[model samples]
Target: MQEIHPLLQPKKYRFIDQSTLGPGFSALQSFAMDDALSISVGEQISPTAARLWVHHNTIVLGIPDARLPYIDKGMDYLHEAGYEVIIRNSGGLAVVLDEGVMNLSLIFPNSKDLNIHEGYDAMVEFVRFLFADLTDEIEAYEITQSYCPGKYDLSIGGKKFAGISQRRVKQGSAVQIYLDVTGSGYERAALLKHFYEISKLGEETRFEYPTIDPSVMASLNELLGTSLTVEDVRERILKQLSEFSEAVVTHPLEGEEIEWFTKRLDQMIVRNEKARENLK
Candidate 1:
């Protein structure tokens, strides 16, 4: 496994530890941060980055999630039930996030010669390495019963605790994954399942939706039988990143990057508005 990871050889890596940014923030704030990082990488003004984030009571939806028959009602339900909803410009269906959910995005160059598999492999390897001390039983396989199930879903003992997604902009790619580090996996899965049931309302669509199984999801705290908080995992990520490379660079969005993010966020807001309007 070590042989496979170092072989990929990303040019440079930056690790952003944003896990302490409270339990909740606006989706636009997070999008702005990603946009800033994307611009930096695309311009070759910065190295590759592994960013960690966590948000509370938020339901991040895919483009299709907004098209459900009663999605407007669902969004209202989510709001009434205390969850902020937003559409991500990436792959995957709706996912629940809270203080327990840790999100990491591996940002890398996307040149003509760069292989897509390289990005995917890098994430899979990084995750395995982070938890090497805990257990080596984690496997990369499709956990269909899990919400937002995908081929690259990260699982342990056939129960999913993480899902991977990717977003590319110009010459930069951000491979994203959300790790359920702690809290009630059933509660989270139930949230997503209810979101689907309320939104889709048995409506048939061209895309096949996931039939979320609450049983197939488990938090690190539950899976390991040890209480592991998101902060603990965040620290582990920093430690692993520091161990993996020399001179790990950590910094917030620069002024120049912030300007670019502002522009990108406006575009994101426009896209989100369209999605919301569709639901209405």
Candidate 2:
């Protein structure tokens, strides 16, 4: 008998699935939603949340990537490749997003006992449990050659399939993960490689970026040898959360939460504006 993760206990949870909301919400809006939701949960107005979201063609950049010497050139390349670019308020390098990818944000009330690594570990355990029937080989470690490399990167058989990042607001912890569900992971990896090649131009920079190798990344469908779609993965998450929680409620943002989201959205817009102005 394997030990169960604390996150998987039968507790109450709020489920929000924005994956089918289409392309109307930008990455900026999504981040704002996460922040606002975190605040709500922290204030005890809501329960822990498991939000699922998907965006069309977009490349979410980290602050460090925005500071690249030739970031303007990189943005141009991404734009030419038919990707909308935004700098995310998170800790990580560039990551690709598409219809085939699914993003999950697990928001919890921050506690003195819940450290940063513990939050990440909870997400890792949740994911592994979600797919336990399909495979038991999921592992979390930094894949050095993959973009957005981190100690908590989720991989299997030495190829990375997902990455996780964390954000905290008030007393809420939003642990986020993006899963490459379907499509060509290599192509996405190659796009970032080209962006980096143009952005860095072999310049000796103070910040060290990962040397991306396209082959080091792979979609879950490719790794698991199944025709897994984003919808399939989304359903897996919902079903697992239902099994883990005594009650999984779906609710919309209310008046005060909407106000908070509005303010955070404005901040996101301002942040993007600054990033774009730098590209000029």
Candidate 3:
């Protein structure tokens, strides 16, 4: 097993939990908040932060997903299925987010000094450390049949439960990962599969969309044979983060941070507007 990097273990870190935010709180705000914190941490206004977030019944699409030939049709399907859709300001294809899915963003400073893979390796190592007691089988590799499949996809026994992605701004970087903590990963994959079936059935696209196989995905609860809620894993995250840092500071977004958030949030809205124009 490879050793965890020292960069991931900051001496001091900021912890922010937005997972308890009610349904009315949009995932859009989470994206903007991360971007703002990334800039703040990069500029030394805030410590390197770990933020926990969850969004209910939302399908966050990548830029390419918005270009699907019959995406408007798929958008209607998602709307009818009670899932709010938005295009994220980062890489990766469509991914499902519900109460059972937990999102983590590790914002770090000095992006210029860290290579992209190093950032992803830090996240992969952190996650491996988080669940070290549960299972040593957790592996990071592309589960090609899963939505938002990537080389850093985290899985156990051939079933994917999480995916990692990175977004960089200014001199700060946010390495994000979404873990299917509870409920059904297969159901989520099925939803995305149906979406692609409807969205690209008749269209010939240049981009190679994933052929989602529902069996290839399963939640951690199912894989570990433990009834773990997102809150449970949230606690696990906090505990592991505490072990990695000397002090964990709970910081609130204020003043200039709020301003940055508002600006980035508006930009996110504008980006989504263009992405969802035909769908709406």
- Candidate 1 per-residue lDDT over residues 1-280, each given as its tens digit: 4564752344456877777778556666776677778778877888878888888788888887776778888888899988888897666788888888999887877544578777777889888988888988889989987888888899899989998887777788778889998888888998888878887788887788889889999998788888887878888887777676665787777779878888888888888888777774
What's the CA error at residue 120 for candidate 1, in Å? 1.1
lDDT of 3 at 55: 93
**Per-residue lDDT of candidate 3, residues 1-280 (tens digit):** 6676877788898999999996887989999999999999999899889999999999999988988988888989999999998898677899999999999999999998888898899998899898888999989999999999999999999999999999898989999999999999899999999999999986688999999999999999999999988898899999988988899989699989999999999999998887677452
lDDT of 2 by residue, 146-198 (tens): 99999999999999999999998988888999999999889999999999999
TM-score of each: 0.94, 0.97, 0.97
Better structure of 1 and 3 per lDDT: 3
Clashing pairs in 2: none
Deviation from truth (RMSD, Å), model 2: 1.2
Q: What is the Å distance of residue 133 in model 2 from its true position?
A: 1.0
Candidate 2: how many backbone clashes? 0
| Candidate 3 local Cα displacement, residue 176, angstroms | 0.5
Provide the lDDT at 168 for model 2.
89
Quick one: best lDDT, which candidate?
Answer: 3
Which portions of model 2 miss their true places by more than 4 Å? 111-113
